[model samples]
Target: MSGNIAKHVFVMAGTGSIGLIAIFMVDLLNFFYISALKNPSYTAAVAFAGSLGFILSAISIGSSIGISATVSRLIGAKKRGKARRYAATFLAVMLCIATLLAALNFIFSRQLVSLIGGKGEALEGAVLFLRILAPAFPLLCLVMAISGLLRSLGEANAAMRVTLSGAVCAAVLDPIFIFGLDLGLTGAALGTIFSRILICANGWYQLSKHDILAFPRLKEIKPALKAIAPIALPAIATNLATPVGNLFVTRTMSHFGNDAISALSVIERSVPICFAFIFALTGSIGPIIAQNFGARIFERVKETYRWALRFTLGCVALIWLIFFLNQNLLIKLFHIQGIGIPIIHFFCDYLVEGYAFLGLLFVSNTAFNNLGFAFYSTFFNWGRATLGTIPFVLIGFYWGPEGILTGMTAGMALFGTLAYFKAKNVIHNLHLRFPEALA
Candidate 1:
């Protein structure tokens, strides 16, 4: 756990440099060209194209998550040999899926972008970028899942190295491709794909270093699939909402006009900075809880949950304050505003101000999501987005988008608190007896 703690933090902090800076990398290159992809049409095109990419990334992420969850479960059962076999199966399956998708993208890039309403040069660019970017899906998916398996076995340091290497690769390649090769958006996409391929290779090599490499026996595949079914499959589908929701938000803002969309884009990109740490913290906690819970170590599970909440909320608050203090300069940096700052600043403030509660929501959902509660996590997240967020967004039309932000703050806060208490009841009945907790 301590190794997981230290290593996950290091890699995530480094990934933040590239992941958080990605939009800027695109925007900066665009700014240099200024004519390549900065117009309203281009903005729309990028938004739509990127949204599709986001959806793809989400699917990949969810698959990785499921892999991590499944592999961790196997590790918890002291089935290292079995875990390795399942890892191989997952690896093989994901490689095929990613390869097929890349082929489809190559065959139908224009159609995929157009189906999502991408237009003009944007559509043309989207085609080039998507085809170039398609192979990354498999690489990222396979590596993330494999890394989870490694982390599951307490090889956090090695897993971190793989994730970090991907980030470093991206950071180094972004400037080189965009500036040196002049590939523009396609360059950014290419850099990302190549980086993931490298990461996948690194992840594979790391696994080969495992004390005992166990090959999956064809015989046990069925039972392994059955055990994994509860965690892996639904996760693949349910995690689609992230990119979907972002698309909805992007489309809604776009309807307001270009400035609205651009401002929202910058704001969305920036908010992830605050979330990066929170994400890392909750994510780090998930596997610990997942493994310990599977083994019925109730006290460790409970302690980890409590400690995660404390650490995450505090981390969220600290970063939220930084965003608050620098709001003016930060808002100005995007250079995309037209009287949107007040609204945008309010959105940021209200969004982060409500972090404690939302962090509660995040931790709870992650707890369930990590521990084979996929349905609950999915339902709550979708519900929160639909029932909780939509109502506020509707109200925003009447009051202002800031009204929507307020509503978001309120909704996330309320839902998070309610979810924590709700989960508490189940937590009580989690079928574990911690004699240590009794003592």
Candidate 2:
């Protein structure tokens, strides 16, 4: 509705986008590791490592959701002290959770790989990569918690700076460790972990200075978790939809052999790099929506959604065009070989077009989480995974990976439509109920 809102979205997006872009950029570097090794099994190993990392990071990511929910509300209520206490409790809880996850993953790395369909050297390599990366989970969780706390406090630029710095460090270190040291896959893991350590270290120092990071008290733990769990648990389940859905997709691709899964891995990692701004748009707008919703300014909430959808759609369109024009060049750039090339070609032809719908889904998920409709977000995602992915993928299996991409697109279309309408209705109802506040 106004230039000011658009300004806020762009400013926030500018900083927020870089963090994930850096993360995914390094993920692409992992794909490069696979290509450099020129082994299908190694490609599969990279795919498996990326998937497992996403699953592990869910603990922190989901906790960030809860932190955002709790902290945003507290910030809105002007409860800075309680928000600080919850922030402390969040770090403590996340540390315990991360440690437990790290231990389990380290001990069961092989079994975990096998569980996800890794075999032979691929299994071994993935295990090594995962174990090397496991200890960083705690550090990563702390980074996410602190960054999220800063975002909730309307300090998104600070959070952005914290995460982007990590990403930059990772980018510089990745090749050095992977290539320079001749450490291979384990080297990639080392680079990523070291960068994470940097983020966590810098994040703590920055937050402490802001008086945001605090020591956890025994008394605060219970209430902090109590406040956070309702939002966090559902949000976690909601977030799991992607990785779980991805797990199923990767498993399906595995049936087609390593080349297929490897190709899918490249696409997965690359797509985020191309569409980082979509994430930035959704993420940066969340606190804006949340604060307005809490303040009962329903129209501003609606306008935020409107501008976000416009921006995301525009960006995805341009991405589709760029990739379409340079499809052959991109294939050459990645130096993809074997069945992976055809799969990449097919994705660029068909699945790349579905990103607009996918972008809408990202926006709607943010809307639901910020507006207190997290369960809806969870429902749509899991529904897409099961109701959307399972049947289509089963049928598409007959036609190969192309068919699988078709199935995934169908799911995106279905849920994306549902999420948008649901978000609109929520805002409309809020408008009616809070007419006085709107005035």
Candidate 3:
């Protein structure tokens, strides 16, 4: 907290990126292994399953954001005891919610898969994959909550290791299960389950070592719920917007053919790998902003936001260049064929730059989520997902899959710009409210 704001943003984001990229890399490799089976049905099935999994993961992420933001603020105020109680209570709450969601998703796996247009082998494979992996939802939530607590305590490396361990576990197990065991799609699901278990173990160990967890009393539960819900509910709604947007894209792509769906899957997995740093920024910057805001250091909070924006732009530029140069390589790497080829080509060439704006949106989201305007995050995200998305996508639908992608990019640019301005306004309002902080 006493160091250079730019350095802090860079260091935290860099270390945080390592773990996030590792996990995403593993996920991309999982898709690669599945694609190696030479079955579009398998690829498409995994795509649908992945979309469904993203929704569940969103819930965990949203809940973790609330836990992290609230606890970090308390810690900044020197209320360590309250922070620990909040941590433990939020963890328990998320566990129960995760369990309930997992059960429902597992029971209705087929219907969920079919709702997004899964068919034949794709339908069967997706259903089996979802059912096999559903039980791990609670594990995922626990790991996320624990990681959040570690980050709130400034244990960035420890938090990174929580995910890094899981990535390594998935990396080693995926090939063996998918190829060596000849389990195909089922193997991938098993790999994911085992990986979550490893992550949960690592996170708990790290958090325990910090003494940041304790079992909450019954009375503590009510207050904890009140503290976390304000942020979490909106944060969950915000996070859910992306998947809801993707759901539209996936459902629409299904109409084009398995080739389009497979291409979409490749693109989806490729994004986090390419922009992992940008994705990491949300988690990495949250604690920094929250702590400063909590301490009433208004200028540092604003400075952090600016530095984060700069870092995001630089990251996006570098990633875009790499993707543009390797467009063909990506297509070949994924063994994309037919309509999938052009779709990948177009995304690498035309749509890559849109992520700059998306990065802006993410920076703004960090501000909104941590600076007590969580509802703004939800509003903008849903606006981007629905108004920013649906109409543009429908217009682009006339041109084909590439057109649909183009429309999505437009929506990103629109909401991202708006959110950036809104976040700046939010920070300015903080100064007005606490003029003494400025003095």
Best by lDDT: 3
Q: Which stretches in model 1 have alpha-carbon errors above 4 Å?
A: 1-46, 73-80, 102-127, 211-224, 287-303, 337-343, 369-374, 398-410, 428-439
Model 3 bad stretches (over 4 Å): 1-3, 73-86, 216-219, 287-302, 428-430, 433-439
Per-model CA lDDT versus the true structure: 0.64, 0.81, 0.87
Clashing pairs in 1: none
State in Å the error of residue 49, model 2: 1.3
**What are the per-residue Cα lDDT tens digits for candidate 3 across 1-439?**
5689888888777877887887676678778988988788898999999999889888988898889879987888998898889778877877887899999999999999989988899999989988998898898788778777787788888877778888889889999999999999989989988888888887877777878877876778888989988878887888899999998888878888888999999989998888888888877788899889878888899899999999999998898899899989988787787899999989988898899999999899889988878778888899999999989988998999999899999999999999999999999899676666421
TM-score, candidate number 3: 0.92
Ranking of all candidate structures by their lDDT, best first? 3, 2, 1
Q: Write the per-residue lDDT of candidate 2 for residues 292-410, one digit (tens) a residue.
A: 88778777988899989988888878888887788788667666767778888888877787888878888998998877677787888888878888888878888988888888888
Per-prediction CA RMSD (Å):
5.0, 2.4, 2.4
Superposition TM-score, candidate 1 onto the true structure: 0.78
Question: Could you estimate the TM-score for every candidate?
Answer: 0.78, 0.92, 0.92
